[model samples]
Structure formats: structure tokens, C-alpha cells
Target chain A: MKDYIQKMQTGGDIVSAITAFVEESKKINEDNHYFTVITEAQAIEQAKNIQKQALTKKFPLAGLPFTVKDGICVQGVETTASSAILKGYKPVFNATAVQRMIDAGAIFIGKTVQDEFGFGALGITQGKGFQAPKHPDDPELCCGGSSSGGGGFTKKIPGAHASLGESTGGSIEAPAAFCGVVGLCPTYSRVSRYGLLDYGTSLDKIGPLTKTLPEAATILQVIAGHDKKDETSSQEPVPDYAASLGNIKGLRIAKIKEAFAEGVDESIKNSVHEKLTELEKQGATVREVSLPSLKEGIATYFTIALSEASTNLAKYCGMRYGQSGSMNTSFDEYFTKIRTHHMGEEAKRRVLIGTFARMAGYRDAFYNKALKVRTKIIQEYKQAFKACDVLSSPTMPILPPKQTEAHNLTPLQHLMCDVLTVGPNLAGLPHVSVPAGKAGIMFIADHFKEEELFRTHAE
Target chain B: MITQDVLDKVAKNARLTLTKEEAAQFLPQLDEVLTHFSTLQDVDTEGVEPSFLPVKLSTEMREDLPEECLTQEEALKNAQSKNGYIKGPKSV
Candidate 1:
């Protein structure tokens, strides 16, 4: 991976690597690893552009070939969001993040697959149309979801260093954890959402999944910061994230008491505890922190997310930019027929729950109540952070389950899998899931304090 | 307590047509999950400001500027059907 980066940086023989990967990508299409590959001509032009930038001393990404989830728009390329409804859709403009990477001299390889509209926590929602590659160790196991192809693509291209993905719930982290890669879910609005398909607009965040923490940090540095196009984009200066890595000697780390309790996989729990002990030996302090409200995070997250999802998805009626010609007698019929025929079952489930929550008489009962509950949950996190510089937990309660079994989970059962992740997302805190022995260890910190979290991990 | 009817209703609101079997399967799970959430109601939050974000934040604004948007063709290219004005099913 380092050699690939260097080649891209130096502009030497990088085209071969890009070409070989594109060919291999075609053969490995079952993983839905790539929706489209840049033609050789396009790859050469991108390399030339990087070389020109390097000559001018503006090499941020140099020639690094990165892939983005299809949900994000790339000018002239299809942004289908892995749904058959928008199979041939192409964007006329690039998402802010995509444009930033391009200006930094990064080569766009292709768009990766994702759960339809990024609503599922498991890759199964990509539907039977796009096949995800099985786990490397266990063929029957899932590769993780929403960003399934984004994460799965990392394993396929030993030469392609990192990829960008979006997370609403556990998409990036879950897939990264299962695939043994690093995933960074930046603070909400740290990256732009403009030009990306929305699913739970308030909860969705764009992040990177990379082979190493350093690589992830590099990508984050490049793509982060304010965007005029996205109203929610933060205007804060993007921190020197890579510069913060080093001795974490005196940092304090807290492990949520509930996360390691009953129901967690024994092996994963042991691995996390062992990692904490190692950090302690390295001179860091570790303690147990109470975050009682965290137990309700998943429930609250679904209520809030699905509620927003219902509204965000309302634009996809057979009237605007998705599957059309499915029905036309009435607006409601058109919407029902198009959505029912095109959206995956998972998308439908969330939309229903969201709609019900916002229904006139029930809004105060469900949506307003969930918002109140969300506030309480956030307060719990703030208090917990005061006692510790960084909080640690297993990235997932269990490792990736079999795809068949995952598909069998009822919607509620599947939402339960997001238990460990929803807390950080609800709080809009910065978190990164790094390899912790055999399982994954997620380190979350106060918003805009990602540097501190990295320092704690390094120590 | 969540019932099959409630599950069905939620599904309908979500624009899903759940089979009777699916409603049966999901109802009990939703009940058990909500029972677990009931524990959170015990926490004392009186007089505490509900937290919306982990870190205190003020919305930051960017200078307003005119920008280009996706062309009608580019925007509608992915639609299954298009009439140049909107994307949807063919009109009878």
C-alpha cells in the first residue's frame, strides 16, 4: 500500500496499477465493488493532472486512486445508490468532497456499491441485483452494510489504498470492523453532504475507510471542512489530524460499563479489555464510565433517523429522479408503485416508521418524544466525556453474521445491531474504529476533538 | 406493548406491505426492544437541558454565492422514465 501511494506521488508507472485494478474490478463485480471504472484514457488524464499539480507544489493526494460510495455524486459518472430505480443516473456536478479530492490530484477509480439509499445496517439491502463478496475468512458471512461495497472493495484491491464512504448508522464502522480495516466517521457535517443521496439527512456523514489509521487521517484532512453547497457543512478549520498521532502517554480512556456487559460476544469483550490493558501499560489511564442513556441509543436513533428518512426520501416519487413509468393514475399511486417496486425492503421499513412518527396525531407521541429523548442521550455523553478524554467500546456487539441469517433478522432485530454505534452518531462525536487485537476498538471523543482520540490510541 | 397490528401499521407508514408472517415475526421483537428502552425512563433528567450534540456547537454559515447545479439532462438521466419536465411513469 505504501508503494502504491509512493508511485502515485511520484507519477511513475501508476497507470498500470489503475488499469490492472479496473480489469480485476470487472472480474470481481459480484462484490458490487465498483459501479463503473474510469476508462484508461480518463486514468491517464487524471495522472497528468496530478503531475501538473505536483509541478506547481500542490500535491495533496498526488496520484492516490480512491473510490467513493455510489451515493456520492461524481460528475459524468452514475450515482445510482445501488438501487435499480436509478440504474442509469449520472450527476452533472461533483459533490464537494469529490471535487476536493480531485483538485488535490487524487484519481477517481470508480463508485462502490451501497445498501439501497444507505438505509440497512447489513450489506444485504443491496438486493439480489448486486452480489457482495463474502467475508474473506468465512464465505457465508456478510461484509457489513450501507457502505458494504466501499468496505469490501478495500480487500479486493491490495494496491488501492483507501476509499471514501458515508455512514448514517454503522455502515462504515461495521463493514470496516468486519473487514479488518480502519473506518473514520467524522463528526456530523465535518464533510459535505451536497450532491450525495440523503438517508436521514441529520444523521448521515461522509467518512473514509482505509487500510491504516494514517491513511484514513490523510483522506480526512483532504476532504473535510466547510462547503457552501451543503448548509450543514461546518465552517471550522480542518485540524491537522495526522500531526496529532504520537505518544498518548497521559490520556484518560473510559469504557462504557454497559457495552461489555451480558450479551456481548465473550471473545470481543476479552479482546477490548486486553487492548485497554495494553494501553494502560503504555501509561494511559483506563476507567469504567456510566452512560446509562446509551442503552436507549439504538431505539432513539431509529426513531429520529427513520423520521428524517421519510421526509428526505419523499423526493424520490416516480415524479422526479427515480424509477418512473411504474404507475400514473394518481400521485399517491405513482409514489407507492415506484417506491414499492424500486426501493429495498429496508428502505421501505424506515420510511414507514418515519412516516408514522410524523403523522399528525402521533408526531408529539413519537417524533417529538424521540427528539426529547435524543437530547437526554446527548447530555449523558457530555457528562461521560467530562470524566474521560476518550471513550472506548467494541465497534460491534458481534462480528459480521452470515448474510442469510442477517437477511432473516426482523427490522427491529437488525436495528439492535446498531447498539454500540448509535451513541457516537447521536452525539455527533468523532470516532474511529481501529483494530484492537482480534476484534475492533472504537474510540470516541468530544466533537472536533478527533486529534485527542488519535493521541489516546497511539499511546 | 407492541402488537402485530402496530408492526403492520408502522410498516404501512413506511410504505412497506409486510406479509402477515413478517408482522408476526417483527412484533414480538419490537415489544422486547421497547421493554428494554423502558429502563431509560428512570434516569433523572429534570432541569437538565436535553443535549443535541456531544460538543457545544454554533451553526457556521458560508458566504452566499451563485453556483451551478446538475443540468436537467444529467439530473433526469437516471430516471426510469422522463418527459423532459419531470421523471415518472408514462402518462396514459
Candidate 2:
């Protein structure tokens, strides 16, 4: 594995690597790891081009093969957000991140499955009755997601070096933890979101899910930078992420008390605790810290994410975009019929609830209040950072539950699974979930501190 | 509780449609989610500003120089058109 990654980074012997990637990607697709796998012709064409470039120039991510989540558009590819509504929407342009990866000489093998419009915490709850990607650790377990297929494929496919995933709350981290892979959720706008289908504009971010922290950092180095097309992207300078991978002598790590609150499985907590103990033994100080507002992060995140989604998705009403509706009595009737028939129950529930929260009477009570609480969450994180270098938590509160059990959970119970992750997401902090056992440990840092986040947990 | 009446009003506001049976099924589930969101009432966010972005943000603009863009044919490629115009409901 070490030799393979080293050769990939240096653009050495790429023909065999590309062949292996295509073969392994096809094998993994048998288990439903991909929504659309790139054709062998496309893979070979890209590989031959990169091999020719290896004679003189060396790109940072040369020869690396990666998978993209379905929500991020790939040019000429069937880029649906795993929704029946976008049934045949092939993008005309590449997402800025995808284009950057291609320019860096990385090969894309396929796009992975996700929850429709990224609304569900459980990976199995897609609109078209698509099965969830099986967990790499235990085939019977649920691959926790919105980024479910990205996490699953990266964990199981040896040929693919990384995966491109998008997250609103815990979409990337949850599946990463469940599949026992490394997932990084960069600071908001750290990577451009110009081509990503919006889940929640204020909360959405594009990130990488990889098998190791170093590989995640390498992918980040290639993908993270401001783009002229994305107005919200930060002007902050991108750091040399790979340079920050060594020596932690006296860093303060804050283990969040709220992560161990009731309902978290004991074994999950013990696994994260063991990792923290090991860090402590390696000259790092571990202290218990409390962010009381973190307890309400789930509710606040949903209020904001759902409201934004209702507006962002309003453009897909079977008009010029998305699959066209046949019932054409009137424009309103056409839209109503199309959305009612094509949209899933989860999507309808979210749109209705979001419209309710944005209603005249309820707007102040729900949407406005959630925004204020979100402010408090950000402030709490800022205050926490004043004392600690990074905040630590179990990426998910429990291990990967069986798909049958996950299917039986109530809507609120499913949302509660993301309690540990939504705080960082709501605050737009840099967070990475590193595999610890069957689950993972998450480290969060202040905005634009991704190097610090990777440095503390690269072990 | 999210009653059928409430669902109807919300569906109308969102330009979406749902059957009576579907509305009935989602009423209680949506009500439970709203009830959970009620926990935000406990925080005394009296003077706090609403957070649209966690960090201070300002949009960076590019020069408005004309560049290559999609042609008329390419722009209309995804549409369901009757002739050269996009097909839609009859207007007055």
C-alpha cells in the first residue's frame, strides 16, 4: 500500500494502475459500489494521456484514481443526486473540483450512490428504491450516509485512492465512520461548490473520503483552493497539508463531554477514549470540555438545511430542468403532478416542513431562532478553540447498525445519529473523521485550520 | 401536531401536491420532528446575530468580460420545445 501511494503521487508506472482501478471498480460495482462507472475506454484514454505527461512533468496527484459522489457533476456523465427527479440529467460541465482533480492527473473511475438530494442519514433511504452500499467492515451493517457509496467504495476498493463527497451535516463523516475510512469535511468554501447540487447553501461543502489521513490530505491539497466561479469560496491561502503531518509534542485536545451524553454506545465511546489516551501518552494533553449548545445542533441543522433545500430544489419542478412531466393541463398542475409523482416521501416531508418553517407566522419562531442558535454554536466553538487546539468526539454515537434495524428507526431517531458531527458543520469548522475501530474519532478545528486538524490525527 | 390542514397549506406554499392519505401519513412524522426542534427555545439568544456563515464572508467578483458560453442550440438542448421556443402552458 505504501509503495503504491508513493508511486501514484510521483506519476510513476500509471498504465498498470489504471487497469487495476477499472477492474477493481467493476468488481466493486457488483456490490453496488457505484451509480455509474466510467467506461474502460474513458479510463484508458485518461491513463494514456497521464502516462505521456510522466516523461517531463510531475503533478501532485498524478496517477491517482478516485470516485465522485453522484451529487457533484461530472461532464457527460449521468450525474443524478440519486433521485428519480433528475433521472436523466447528464451535466454539460465538470464540477470545479472534478476538473481540478483531472487537471492534477487523477483518474475518475465512477460516481457513487447517495441519498436522494442528500436528505437522509440512513444510506438505504433513496428515492428510486436503490439499495444502500454494504459496509466494508460488516456486509450486513448499514453504510451510514448521504455519502454512503463514497465511503463504502473507498473502504473496499484498493485501486481507488480517494472519493469526492459532499456534506450538509454529517453526510461525509457518518458514512466514513461506519465504513471505517478517513473522511475530511473541510471548512465551508474551502473547496469550490460551483458544480455541487445544493443540500443547504449555508451548510454545504465538498470534501474527500479516503482510506488514510495522509491520502485524504493529498486529495485535499489538490482540491482545496479558491475558484473564480464560486463566490462563497474563501480567499484564504491554501496550506501545504502534507507538510503538517509530523510531530505533536504539546497540543491540547479537547474531548467533548456532550459526545458521551446518553444514548451513545459504550463501545464507541471506549474506542474514541482509547485513541485519546494514546494521544495523551504521546505528549498531548487531553481535557474534558463542554459545549452545552452542541446538544441542539441536530435540530438547528435540520431547520436551516431543510429550509435552504426547499428553495434550492424549487428549480427542479419538471420544467426545463429535470425529467419533464406529461400531465400538462396548466403550468401549476404540471409542476404539482411531476413533483408529487417523482419526488419521494422524505423529500416531500422536507419541502413541506421547510415551507412551514418559512411561513409568515412560524418563520420567526423556527427559522429565525435556529439561525440564532447556530450563531451560539459557532461562538461556543470559537470559545472552545481559545483553550484547546482541537475538539475530539466519536464520529458517530454508535457502531454501524444492521440495515434492518436502521430501517426500523423513527425519523427523529435517525437524525439523532448525527448529533456528534452537526456542531462542526453548522459552525463551518474543519473536521476529519479517522477510523479508530469499527467506528472513528473526529477532530475539529477553527475555520481554515485544516492543517491543524490533519496534524493532530494523522496517526 | 401537523394536521392535514397544515400539510395542505404547506404543500400549497411549496408548489407541491400530496394526496389526503399521504398527508395523513406524514402529519405525525413531521410533527415529531417539529417537536424535537422546540428545544431551541431553551437558549437565550436575545442579542446574538443570526449566523448565515460561520466566518465573515464577502463575495469575490470576477470581471464581467464576455467569454465563450453555450450557444442557443446548446442552451435549449435540455428543454421540451414545440419549435424554437420552449413549450409551456398557454398564456393570455
The prediction achieving the highest TM-score against the true structure is: 2
**DockQ of each two-chain model:** 0.37, 0.65
- Candidate 1 residue pairs in backbone clash: A89-B78, A325-B88, A325-B89, A351-B14, A352-B13, A352-B14, A375-B51
Q: Which residue pairs come into collision in candidate 2?
A: none
Give each model's clash number. Answer: 7, 0
Fraction of true contacts retained by every candidate, in order, equals 0.39, 0.64
Residue B41's lDDT in candidate 2: 81
> For candidate 2, lDDT tens digit of each residue in A42-69?
7778888988886577666777787899
**lDDT per residue (tens digit) for residues A1-459 in model 1:** 556566566656555666676677667664444443444467667866666656446466777778889889887777778876676566778888889888877788788878888877767777436655566556787777778877777865666557889888888888888778889999888898888888877788899998888778788888899887777777789889877775578889999898897878899998888988988988889999888778778767877787788888877775655456745476566666667777765666567667766777667556666667788877778888888888999998888898889878866677887789888888788888887765688998887787876675453
Please list the C-alpha lDDT of all candidates, in the order they appear: 0.74, 0.84
